[model samples]
Target: MSQFPHPSLPSSVKEPWLAVNLSLFFPGIGQLYAGKIIRGHSLIITQVGLYALSGWLILSQIGNIFIGELLLITAFALSIWGIFDAYDCAKTANSPSFEKLRTSQKDPWLAVFLSRLVPGAGHLYINRLWFSVLFFTFFVISLLVQLVPILLKSLIFYHVYIASTIRRERNQLPILGMALVSILFSLIISLQIFFIKTHIADTHIIVTNEMKPTLQRGDHVIVDKQIYRFKSPQRGDIVLFSPPEPLQDNHFREAFIQRIIGLPGERVEIQNGRVYINSQPLEENYPQKLSQYSFIPITVPANSYFVLGDNRNHSYDSEDWGFLPRPNILGKVTKRFFPPQRIGIVSS
Candidate 1:
C-alpha cells in the first residue's frame, strides 16, 4: 500500500446536529460550518437575492397576488432544501470510510426535528437536561394559559349531553356529535379569519406620531380594504397607501397613513398654517398641529389625490412627494381598537 491517506478521509469530523441547527437558524450557515465554502456562499447569495426580489415585488406591485404567492412558495422550498442538504453534508464528512468518529446512541438530528414539533421534546431525546427543562416549562405554561380555557369551554358540551341523557340510555353518538361540531366550528372560524385578514380588513400598529391626537404611536387600528373597492375615497378621509418612489429611497418602506386634503382636479395650497382649497380657506374641525410652511397652489391630477398628516410639520406626505396615485392607496383606517382607553371610530 502507498504511504498516503485516502482522499475521502476528512481532516476533522463534523457534528451533524450542530450543522443542522446552524442551517435552521440561517440556510447557509450550517454548510459553512461543515467546510462547504462554495456551496454555503451560493446558498446565502441565492437566499438574499430571492428575499430582495420578493420585497421589491411586494412594495412595487402589491396587487400581483399570484406572483407574490409563487415567490413565497419558492422561498419555502429552497429553505427546506438548504436545511436537509446541510445535514447530508455533515453526515458525509463524518462517514466511517473517511474516519472513525464518535457516534451517539440517539440521533441528534432526529432530536432537532422532534424539538420543532414540540418545543422541548428534541432536547429531552438528546439528553440536553437544562434546555429540555426550560422548553418543557414554557410549553406547559403556554398550554395552561391558552389551551386550558378552550378545554374548559369544550366541557360545556359534555355537560349539555349529560343533562339531556338524564332519562334515557346514554350513547356514544352525543360525544361523536360534539367532536364533529367542534371541528366544523373551528374550520369555519379559521376560514373567516383568513378571508378577513387577506381581503376584507387588516390590523396595523401605528409606529409614528405623524397622525398625532387622531392616531398616536402604539395605537392599533383596523384598515378597511374592501370599502375603497366599492366607493372612491372622499376628501377628508384618512387613508393608508404606499409612499412615492423618491420617499422610499430614504428608507420609508411602510405604507403612509394620511388625510385626503385635495381631491382629483382640485387646487390646494397651504399658506400661513391655514389650508386653502380652490382659493378658499377650508373649515377645520379635526385636531391638527399645523405648520407655518407654505405650499404654493397646485392642482391635483386626474385619478390622484393630495394628502396631508394631522401633524403637518412632522409628516412626510403628498406636500413633499406630490399627488398620490389612485392605485397606490391600500385602504382607509376605520377604527382604533387598542390601548383600551383610546379605542373608537377614527373620524376625519
Candidate 2:
C-alpha cells in the first residue's frame, strides 16, 4: 500500500515539468496545481508584494541606477527559487512525508509582516540566523553607500528573503491583518507609480523604425522629465514630444521620438541627403540612413525646434508637419534599459 493512500491523493496527478512552467508564468501557480493551497497563495502574495515594492522604489527614484539593478537581481533570484520549488513540490505531491512537512510549516505571512516591520525580523522568526545576518549586513551597506534608499532596500531584501523561506517549505494560511496590510501597501504603491510616471520619469517603447540604428522598433528607453527644466533643448538631442498641430489633424495623437536637427532662430534646410544649419553642413556623427531630399530653407521660429527622424528616408518628422513647439517637448531619452546587450546611455 502506498504511504499516501489513494483516497488522500489529488484527483489528477500533477506533472513536475508542468508545475515548473506554471511557476515560470507566476510563482505560486504551480504549488496550487500541486495541491499546496496555502503554500501557493503565500508565494503569489509574496511575489506580488516584492514586485510592488521594487516598482515603487524604481519609479520614485528614477535616477538611482544601483537600486534598480539590485532590485532586478533580487527579482531574478526569487524567480529561480520559485521555479525550482514548484518542480520539487509537484514531484512529491503525493508523498506522505511531503504532506507531513506541509502541515508542519510556519505562517509565511507572519514572516512577511515581521520583515516589513523590522529589518531581518522575518528571518529571525523563522530561525534563519544566517539570512538574518546577511540582511542586516545589506542594510548596513546600503546606509554606508548612500546610493540606495535604505528603507526601500530593506523592504526588497526582506521580501526576497521571506519569499525564499516560503519556497523552501509550505506555510499556514496568512492572518487577516497580514492580508489587509499587503493590500494597503499595494494600493499606495500603485497611486505613487501613477504620479511618478506623470511628473518624474517613465519608460517608453519604440514602435516605429523612425530612429533606426540609435533606437530600433521594440527598443525600451527611459525618458527624463526633469532634464529640460535645468537646461534648454540642444541640437542632436533625442526628444519625445506630442505631434505638432498639422500632424494632429491626421490622427497622430501619440507622441513622437526624434532628434532635434535645428534650434530656435536657425536657418534649417535639407538638400543632397545632408542637413545644413545656417548654410553650414551639420557634422553628422550618429547612425542614420539619410535620404536625398531637398527642402526650401526655412528659419526655425523662436521657442520652437525643428526635429527629424534618424531614419531620414522613412520618417515623418519636421519635414512633414513643421517645427515642434517647445512646450510640446515632453522629455529627453537618456538610457535604453532593455535588450540587455544594448543597455547603456543613449548619447547623441
Candidate 3:
C-alpha cells in the first residue's frame, strides 16, 4: 500500500510535484491523477454542470445577446480548466505519493479518460507515439473535413456582413444579425463545396468508345450545374443531365452529357440524317458527320430538353432515354482536361 503522510507524522513525503497553479487550470484533471479521485470527480461534475447551465441559458432566449456572451465565456473557461488539469496530471504521474504504489496498480483511468476525451493528445502525454499518431490522423482528417466547410461558409458570411453593415445600424442587433447571417452563409457555401467535392454528377465523361471522335473515350469532363441556372439551355450547348428514364437493370440513375438539339415546347423531328427543331434545321458547326443518319424525334415538353451525344449514331441519349428535365441539368462541358492532345475547351 502507498504510504500517506498522516496528521501525526512529520510531513515527509516529497512536496506535490505539480504546481498548485496547474490544478487551478482544470478542476478535476490534476486531482484525479494526484490520487485524489473524489476531488477530481467533483471538479469534473462541477464543470459539466456549468456547461449544462450555460447551454440552458442560451436556449432559454432570455436576453439572448447577453446569454450568448456568458455561454461563450463559460465554455472558454472550461476549456482552460481542462487544459490545466491535463498538464498537472501529466507532471505528477510519477510523484513520491505514487512511488510506493506499484506502477501496474496506479489507476490509469484518468489517462484513458483523457485519451477518449481528446484522442492523440492524451496519448502524447503518455509517450504513446504510435497510438498517438493513429489517433491524431483520424481526428485531424475528421476535423479538417468538418472545419473546411465551416471556414468556407464563414467566408461567405463575412461577405454578407460587409454588405449588410452598409445599411444596418451598428448596434447589438446588427451584430446579432451579422452573426446569424454569417452562420447561414457559411452553411450554404459549405454544403455547395461539399456536394461538388462528393457528387459524381458534378463530373463525368464519355468512358466508352461510343462517343469517340467527338467526345473521346479518354476525355475527362466537368459538369456545370450552374449552366442553366440563369439562362435556359439553348440548342447546341453541350449539357450534362440525368436521363428521365434510365435503361438497363441495376442502372439506378445516371447523368448523360450531350448536346441540346431541341428546346422545351419545340417540335423536334429527325429526317434521314438531319435534325429539325420546330421544322427548322439545326444550325451547324460541330462535327457535321454525326448528322449522317436520321432518327425519330418528338416535341420536347416544357421543363424538358432533347439531348444527343456528339457521336450521334451510337450515343444512347434522349433518342433512347427520353427528354432531360431542366432541373436534371448538372453542367455543361466547358473543357476537356485529359489526354494532352485533346486538352482544350469543349466547344459547342
Candidate 4:
C-alpha cells in the first residue's frame, strides 16, 4: 500500500455504488474512484494479460469457435471478481483503497462522470499528471489487445516493467517499454495471421448431408494430409476428395469428402444394404442403414477406388458415379469442430 494520507470525511457520505458500476465497463476505474489506484491497476493488468494470451493461442480456427469458450469463461470470472471486490472495498469506508472525497475540491460525481466519458479525464480534472498519463497508457494497452483478431498477442506481458516500476519517481522506462512491446506484439500477430492463411492446414468441413447421422454438415474436420502421402486411404476411412464434377445436388467442382467403401483391386457389392468385400460379409464399426438395394460384385480398378457417403439412401457415391478416381483422393477427415458441445477428434 502507498504511504498516502487520507483526506478527512464528513458524516453523511454514502457508500460508493457508482464505483462498482464503473468497474463493470472499465476494470480499473472503480479502484481509481476508491483511491485504490494500485489495486485498480493490478486488475487492469490481469484482465489485459488474460485477454491477450487467449488471442494468441486458439483464435484462428475458421467456421468453428472452439477457442472462444476459454476466453468467455476467463472474462466472466474476471468481471465478477472485480465487481465484487470493488463493491466490498467501497462499502468498507475505512478500507485502505476507499478514501473520503473532499467536498471543497471537485465533486466526486463530476470526477466519476468525466472518467466514464474519457477515462483519464477524471485524473486530469484533479490535476494529477502522473495518474492521467498512467491511466491513458493502460487504456491504450487494453484497446490494442481488443482490436486484433483471434491471434496470439504478447503485448501485455510487458506490463511487468510497469508493475515493477509503479513506485519509482521520474520513471520513463516503463512507458517506452510498453510502446516497444505493443509494436512487437502487433508484428507477431500479423505474421501469424499471414502464416495461417498461406499455410492452409489439412482442415476441412463436412459440406454435405450425405454423411448424415455420422458427420453432419458444417462440421469442421482435420484431414491427415501427410498420412496418405505414405499410405493409401484405407477401408472405411473418411476421405476428403477433389470430386470429378458436380454430383447429385452437390455442385462442388473441387474437393469432396466420403468414406472409402472399397479399396484398390477389391470386389465390392451390397446385398440387402449390407456391404460385402470379396464375397464375404464386411463388419463395420460405423453404422449402416438397412436397405433392400442389392449391388452386383464388381472389381475395383487397379488404381481407382470405390467410395460412398455413410448416408446410403441419400448419397450419390461410386454406386451412382462409378469408382471415385484415384486422382480425386486428397486425404482423410480426422476430427470434428463445429457445434461446441460435441467437439473432439473424429473416430472411425
Best by lDDT: 2
Question: What TM-score does each of the candidates earn?
Answer: 0.50, 0.57, 0.45, 0.47
Query: Cα lDDT of model 4 overall?
Result: 0.63
The best candidate by TM-score is: 2
Which tens-of-lDDT digit does each residue in 45-114 have in candidate 2? 8778777766555444244444565676787788789878887888786566544644555434346545
Query: Of models 2 and 3, which has the larger TM-score?
Result: 2
C-alpha-based local distance difference test score of model 3: 0.57
Residue 91 in candidate 2, Cα distance off native in Å: 23
Q: How well is each residue in 1-348 modelled by candidate 3, as lDDT tens digits?
A: 422224432322212222232343345655664566776787778777766675444333132324444665876786676555555555455555444442333223333334434555445555566756775566656666856544433333233223221211223343244345545665776787677544522446576654556687768765555545567777888876655545534374655667888788988888877788878887668774445666665789998888877677777777777777877777676655456566555677
* Candidate closer to the true structure by lDDT (higher is better), 1 or 4: 1
lDDT of 4 by residue, 94-200 (tens): 53332433232343334443554465665666566576677666776666675432111222222322333122223444335434544565667768756654343
The alpha-carbon deviation from the true structure for residue 65 of candidate 3, after best TM-score superposition, in angstroms, is 47
TM-score of 4: 0.47
Better candidate number, 1 or 3, judged by TM-score: 1
Clashing pairs in 2: none
Model 2 segments beyond 4 Å from truth?
A: 1-71, 75-174
Cα RMSD (Å) between model 4 and the true structure? 11.2
The residue-level lDDT of candidate 3 at 247 comes to: 51
Candidate 4 lDDT for residue 321: 80
Q: With candidate 4 superimposed using the best TM-score fit, by how many Å does residue 129's alpha carbon deviate from the native?
A: 26
